[model samples]
Target: MDKNLLGNNVIAQIGILVHDIEKTSQVYAEFFGMMKPEWSLTDAVDKAKTEYKSEPTEARAKLAFFDMGSLQLELIEPDEHPSTWREHLNEHGEGPHHIAFFIKGMEEKVKLLELNGMALTQKGEYTGGRYAYMDTFKELKVMVELLENDN
Candidate 1:
């Protein structure tokens, strides 16, 4: 079997696009006994550090993360600005958006995916690392997120 692209078999997170992160998170917490997630706004994201469709773009969203054992559940509520989250929500409504893999060789994996015809849809940096979202939805039925954390 080909080695896993992420180098690990574990899925880091399952991301969902929601119209209202607070409401959706509440539902998840109530239904699954998951703890309340800590919310973070995308306002701190540097637009100069982000790209969409290979072009500079501005996008923002409210995000919440809940740790579930070795994995995490990520909820995203897109802001009024145009973003991958907004695009997914508009096209498919609020639902499953992507599954993330925490990897080390981010650029190499991204290039590999591109060579395989998966387009890079979005990319940005945060506190500890950077992330890239690949447009693999057509083939995989869900976007693939690659995260490289500086640890």
Candidate 2:
């Protein structure tokens, strides 16, 4: 098998889609014995800075992150917008949606994925970082999200 596109030995954050962030987060916190996570809305994502399938979009979602030692568990409550989160929930129901890896050389990585026939399904900017989701489910059985933190 060819090497993984996301690189080997890099920890990835597990992302899940939920119908209600508060309820799901509460359950996760209780199960993990961690403090309640602070959820953040994706409303601040400028529509002009987002795209879906290479087209402009106004997708949004509610996100909460819980640090679990070296990795994070991300809970996503998607709005009625046209985002990958919403699409995943609609297609797969409440469950794991994607695996995200923080990366450098984002443009190059994106290009490489594109060359390999993976299309970018979603992309947006939030705070100090930008993220792109590649539709790799057909081959990898899961979407791949690349996060670039400029901090």
Candidate 3:
């Protein structure tokens, strides 16, 4: 327990990033009878194929957020382009990718992670959330994301 970092009051938002988002989401839908949460759907269609190039992308994703009473289940699928989903699938096949911890000292924590030798792939803000992606998997492997709700 990181206490002030990932405060104990925060809820768990479990994530599963599959190459085929729909197929994986279906599994949860069957088991828990979970449907997509309306307000949590976010798809990034502008992210580049490899890097954050200026070029447009068909790289899309459908994330279904399922309310599991205490903890929530987030199911993700990449649109076959530049993404953690694509990269993860290329190496490890389909599986649960990252566990996002809700933190308070995001900038400070990022600096600490870098100092400790964790590979930071990208560090930036999205909407109102401040996030840092670090490579914790084998190659350009799984990204351990620290998301701080700046709002």
Model 1: per-residue Cα lDDT over 10-58, one tens digit each: 7899999999888889999988886778788875446337777776667
Q: How many clashing pairs in candidate 1?
A: 0
lDDT (Cα, 0-100) at 74 in candidate 1: 92
* Highest lDDT model number: 1
Clashing pairs in 1: none
Give the higher-lDDT candidate: 2 or 3.
Answer: 2
**Candidate 2 Cα errors over 4 Å, as ranges:** 43-48
The lDDT per prediction is: 0.85, 0.84, 0.60
Each candidate: RMSD? 1.9, 1.8, 4.8
lDDT tens digits, residues 68-92, model 2? Answer: 8888999999888777888889999
- What 10-residue stretch in candidate 2 is worst by lDDT? 1-10
**Number of clashing pairs per prediction, in order:** 0, 0, 0
* Residue range with the least summed lDDT across 10 consecutive positions in model 3: 46-55
Decreasing TM-score order of the candidates: 2, 1, 3
Considering lDDT, where higher is better, how would the candidates rank from best to worst? 1, 2, 3
Q: Estimate the TM-score of every prediction.
A: 0.91, 0.92, 0.70
